[model samples]
Target: MFSPKLLLISAIAVALVGSILAISSLYANAQNDEEKAVNSRGMGYYQTTGDVLDPAGSSGSASTGIEPMKYLRTFNYGRVSTLPNGTTLREFTMIADDRQTMEISPGVHYNVWTFNGTIPGPTIRATEGDLIRIHLINNGTHPHSMHFHGIHRAEMDGVFETINPGGQFIYEFYAEPYGLHLYHCHVQPLEEHISHGLYGVYIVDPKTPRPDADEMVMMMNGYDTDSDGENNFYTVNGVPFYYMHHPIEIEKGRLVRVYLVNILEFDQINNFHLHGNLYHLYRTGTDMEPDDYTDMVTMSQGERAILEFTYQYPGQYMFHAHKTEFAEKGWTGMFLVKE
Candidate 1:
């Protein structure tokens, strides 16, 4: 009952409908694929697809369990407090987010934005399973936050929650599985924030404290004089040639514990070397046992170590980065051992 021309038109219409259906299905598939990609890469507060609770796994951008807070006992110091609940409570506060000129080396000054007006904020210490609270006030012309190497709720992790100038923030978390860690301003242009000295060391001691010893803290850092993405002057504990000029005094035959942290930016690697001794090294405080016995250890940026040694004899011993240029640039130090 249909003419030939009508049959041709009908076939054409059917083909058009099929093409439309095919295109619609393809488009839907593409949307699903994009969603999957986003989920895999993580979105928003989610930094990784891996288990966030795993304190031993590596999460994206964060050290997670591999690399590495806070609470209401209002405090301005960096020490651990024990709670009746078997949890240790640690508290800290930092101020001064504005820029100021600092003496990087002897007669060499650079403008730095500091926490508490120091190049390396404050050294914080605590025991494993301790709860920590940090209060931060921003007095500079920028927004910033404190990001630590610990496990915590995503919202409490301190990223994306920035405190603007004249503002403040409270960060709290538990210190898990002891280790030497770091805290820094995680704001954008991280290089600028960290390089300007808004960083510090965090030490989480083991439940059974390592044998009593003479404990000390040393941190390595660098200053970029020209803002050229390369460090010009290297320092330990904020000043260049400080230790070389005023060597650390120690008692011979006494166990010495050193919490060493490296916060140098724009450098490939920095290191610590002792001229006259070897040390039992804990490459982070995670292990109950020493990781190795060595004379020198190399650390990348933000890495830390716990070293134990006993000077067998009383004398002057040298310690510094093995990188000769860094040493020449004022990273050298000495330990004066006495009976």
Candidate 2:
């Protein structure tokens, strides 16, 4: 027979152990909820699929015999009109999404304001001297206008004084200078406009023949959004991680060129890295002298870089920012090589 006091002591010890276990279980559950919330808050749900085409290989020609086009004509933007090639140029409306109140990425939900409900808007490619007529259709309450970076024409500068709600404006300018460039909202409260996500990349291929490889374009930007509170958002081509476009494809031992442009409101120093290839940066800005070249290049705000490289191996490789923070926030992409 146990003493009454001993029995009471044993009961108290058991109760204490049970309480500890229950508390631990509750804590773990709470932690899991927090993790899920964090993930849900970072989703920017968007996706697309298309076959990657090698500009070099598609146009059959030998390396030495390859001849670049002398001059390319620009495609005029119109109200959903068809091009001579049967391609269509249509009017687009960009709307803003609150990053603070919406769920975006996979397993993450956060508020973000985006153009046309998408980050980075759309990629606009045109030939030299093409008239680009973009009608600024402001769907959000905020006033917005777009400025073409590196474009010297005054009418296309997207002056705030020239914009109105639901008002349309035509930017008719020739793409005289060629290289990588950008266009973004330039209305007052510029910082707020950019932070809300209204920007994209523009590429003007040279009239001459390019290398015998693949071509890719990337636009880097940063944002700050309120989600339950304010949070920082950054991305390459409007998406973080591997969400935007999967690994970019290339042929083994073929040359590749990437046109990189940064249109962030703030000055950024972006360090680009390829997983298993060495790149030669050959040109910068709209004023690319005929045959200028450099192994590595750095571009400032409103600047561009043309990077050329050859893949020696066949696999999927990551190309991303050396800035770890950007990489975590989605400033990364993949480079793929096929045997």
lDDT of each: 0.76, 0.56
Separately for all candidates shown, the number of backbone clashes (residues 3 or more apart, or on different chains) is 9, 25
- What is the C-alpha lDDT profile of model 1 across 130-248, one tens digit per residue? 79888889989999888887677887777889889999988888876688888899998989888888887777777787898887778788889889998887877776666665668
Q: Write candidate 2's Cα lDDT for 8-106 as tens digits.
A: 999999999999999888877333221211112245322223332221121112221101111011122335555697544444444433333332333
Model 1: residues with Cα > 4 Å off, grouped in runs:
1-86
Q: What is the lDDT of residue 62 in candidate 1?
A: 29
Residue 59 deviation, candidate 2, in Å? 38
Q: Runs in model 2 with CA error above 4 Å?
A: 1-104, 110-115, 227-231, 243-245, 265-267, 285-297
TM-score of 1: 0.75
In candidate 1, how many Å is residue 212 off?
A: 0.5
